[model samples]
Target: MDVEADVIVIGSGPAGLTAALHAHESGARNVLLLEREEELGGILKQCIHNGFGLEQFKKDYTGPEYAERLIEELEKTNVQCFLNTMVVSLSPDRTITAVSPEKGVFHIKSRSVVLAMGCRERPRSSINIPGTRPAGVYTAGVAQRFVNIDGYLPGKEVVILGSGDIGLIMARRLTLEGARVKGVYEIMDYPGGLKRNIVQCLNDFDIPLYLSHTVTEIQGKERVEGVVVSKVDQKMNSISGSEQSIPCDTLLLSVGLIPENELSKEAGVELTPITKGPVTTETMETRVPGIFSCGNVSTVFDLVDYVAETGMIAAGNAARFAAGDWKKGRNPVEIIPGENVRMLFPQRYSFKDDLILFVRSAKPIEKPVNIELSPLGMRLKRLYARPNEMIRFKVSRDKLKAVTGPIEVSITER
Candidate 1:
């Protein structure tokens, strides 16, 4: 099959669905939405929690509900959709080759492409726990799918490694399902998930969160019998005498997430080493002009609202590109992170209008501080900040125009 669309969206997650909707609304009527799953909702289908859509919908909605709303909106439009399709590769000129059972080896030549392949969980192998390859080990997301989607209990006893949002949520989930979650361990003193998740999921459930702790070894051979955990110093080196064994049948890892960008890389988009995602401009356009990126594919965003906002931004710009109204000109100023700042998405900004810079700190700030974009003279007050929580600031064009060079963002204690 040979198909063509004004905009080709790679994933059917919240980001891709919104991108296709906005693209269609922006006069790019021939928008195509593709999903590898049999359904359209992506990971949200398995995420049955109720914290989602608080920002976007101004009310608490479950993950599936949030995705259902977007999917419903997409259905109201003339957008074409292909489910259970696997995109093989994307070319530099915006050509896509994908395969599906119904439509074998289909090709698409699109004017602009929005890549929203989302992210993947970092497994135990990435951290390389000193233990045998056990059958009971699972990623937090896998456990979520097992319980939420398949209605299968992973284990009666669970020990979670890493305080990632998924792990914290799973800790509560397993506990609710009558499983004894021994504890949640983290190498860093601070939690990796949002404050709300830590409070509602872990603290509320009476699950102990072990700070500066890590799993030193996996004790079981066939299935998980127990794990040896130890306290770590600032350098993350294990303390010899601090090791303790916690017996459990399952160990769910929630270490981190890696952006799915092999397709972006194959299409020749330049990615940042820190983000492991494409270095996109303010318009969410990659260094390769016609291809755009948004959502978890651009960076691991904390909120679905922000991801949808990026999708709209990319779609608007893509519509302009498809309409021949876009004139690619000056280079965008680099946005760099300085002291106490860990990462900032949309690493490169070129637009002169108002734009939002989403940032994460290197450490948790106990005292009040000001997030300053220096040389540009832009400052915003943040009462408190955490490495796990992303901070967003809207910068005016006047403030941005004051800088002739790259801008550095840092946190200054007040």
Candidate 2:
């Protein structure tokens, strides 16, 4: 079968669904949302924990609740949805090839495409932790699915590596499910997860947190056994004689999440080395004009609200691109990171509208830090944020209209 639409959004995650709804609302008559799973909700279906949709929905909700709200909203529109469909490849010319149980092999020619395939967690194999290939090691998300949705206990004893939100949440969940959580180990000097999660999930649960440490070796042979964790120096090297062994049947890793950009690469989209996603302009448009990306597929977001908001931007731009209403020749400005600032998104910026800059600090800050725009050295924004917190600052288009060179964001102790 051959399908045609003004906009084709890949993945039925929050990003894809929100993009579809936004595009349809923007008068894109033919918007299609495709999902590979049997259902519309993506990872959210397995995420039974609350703490989502405070910004978008104005109320705290579980992952499924947030996704259901968007799904209900989409039902009021003319947007079409394709479930159990997997997009195999994407072409630079806005062509999509996908297959499904019912449709077999199909083709889609969309004027604009939104790549919102979301992200996948990094596994133990990716980190090269030396040990016998065992059955106990699982990524935090996978473990989340198994425990939350599959109605099965992963393990009675657990040791989570990396203090990412998922791991922290799982530490609490496992404990609630009558599991013994040994501790959470993070390679960084501070927790990788949000401060709220560390407080609520780990600290409140009495789960020990080992910062600046890592699981250097896995001791399990066949079924399971234990792990060897060691403290790491500033350079991430294992400190001599600092090794400690903890016995546990299962090892959960929440090391990191990587944007699933294989299709982006196949479609020949230029990706940023920092985000590992497509290099998007302020409008979220990729180098290939009509192709836009958002959500975890572009960059890992700390909150789902930001993902949905970014999806709206991508979808709005995509709708305009499809309608041939997009104006060209906007001068682009680069966003450069300053001292102690890890990285910034939307590598290229346009002054056509207000732009929100999302950034992460290299380390935790105990004192207030001024986030200022430099080379004019104006203080665009300020926040007292820790390393685990992702800070966002909005620069109105009018504020950037007069600037010509790159926008520099700096952090200084106050």
Candidate 3:
């Protein structure tokens, strides 16, 4: 069967939910939201924690509560939502191919589309840790689902690798669930998660956090028995005499996240090597016009509030595009990451409106730092910055008058 909508949103995560709601509110009738999962919340349904909604709603809410709130608001709108629907392919011309057990196979032709499929955790195979095929090895996200959703304890003794937010959160979660957490080990010299997580999840719980350490070997035949931990030098080469044995039944990995962009590739959207996400303009529209990207699909965002914010940006512009109120063919300016800046999004600027930039630092830097934007001479100061936390700043359209060419963003230390 064939369907049509003014706006089509893929994925029912925070970004997609917000995009669909805002698109309908922005005057796009027939907004269609498709979700692959049986539920509407995406990963949030399994995230039973409470550190959400502070930024967007000014209230601290558990993951399910936040999702329920959004779902409630969406029910009030005219957005048409379909759960258990998997979008198999997306076309540059706004054609979507999806399959569902109920609908069999269907196609959707939309005036505009939003990509908000989010991201996935890096598994043990991605890190290539030398280990036997064991049953106790799982990504932090999988462990979270097992405990929070499936009502099963993963293991009694857990050894967490990587200090990413999920790993850190799981370290505490597993500990609270009667699991003896040996420690959280990180290959990096610094923590991978936010300072708040490090403090609340590790420091407060009296759990040890070992920096510049890695698990060299997982020793187990059937289930996990133990792991060989080793200290690494600045270059991440394990030191010969720094090996230690730690007995643990389970190993959790939270090394990194990769944006889900297979559909983006099918649509021939240009992606950045740095972010592994689609190249977007200031309005969050991808290289393929009428198609937009947001949330973790744009980049592995640290906060859900920003994820929803990007959805609004994408939806507002998508509604305009669907209504033929958008102007095309403008000279796009490049936004470059300079010294001490690791990643920057919205690589292209239209210079038509104000812009918000998301930035990540190359390394952790102490107080008295300034985020400097060249050519336009815009600067924002911060007390401290780290690669784990993203920095957000805005540039007004009025400032574009001073920018003759590309903009270089960098972190300047005092």
User: How many clashes does the backbone of model 2 have?
Assistant: 0
Per-residue C-alpha lDDT of model 3 across residues 1-414, encoded as one tens digit per residue? 389988999999989988988998899988999999998988999888888989999999988998999899999998999999999999889899999999989999999999999999898889889978888999999999999999999999999999999999999999999999999999999999988899999998999999999999999999999999999999999999999999999999999999999999999999998689999988999999999999999999999999999999999889989998989756788999998999898788987668989999999997789999997787899998899999988888888756668899999896
Q: Write the per-residue lDDT of candidate 1 for residues 299-365, one digit (tens) a residue.
A: 9888888988888888888888887778766668898988898889878878634667898888999
lDDT for 34 in candidate 1 is 88
Model 1 residue runs over 4 Å out of place are: none
Q: Compute the lDDT for candidate 3.
A: 0.92
- TM-score of each prediction: 0.98, 0.97, 0.98
Candidate 3 backbone collisions, by pair? none
Instruction: Give residue 323's error in model 2 in angstroms.
Output: 0.5
**Per-residue lDDT for 10-109 in model 2, tens only?**
9988899899999999989899999999999899998888999998878999999988998999999889999999999999998999999999999999
Candidate 2 local lDDT, residue 353? 66
TM-score of 1: 0.98
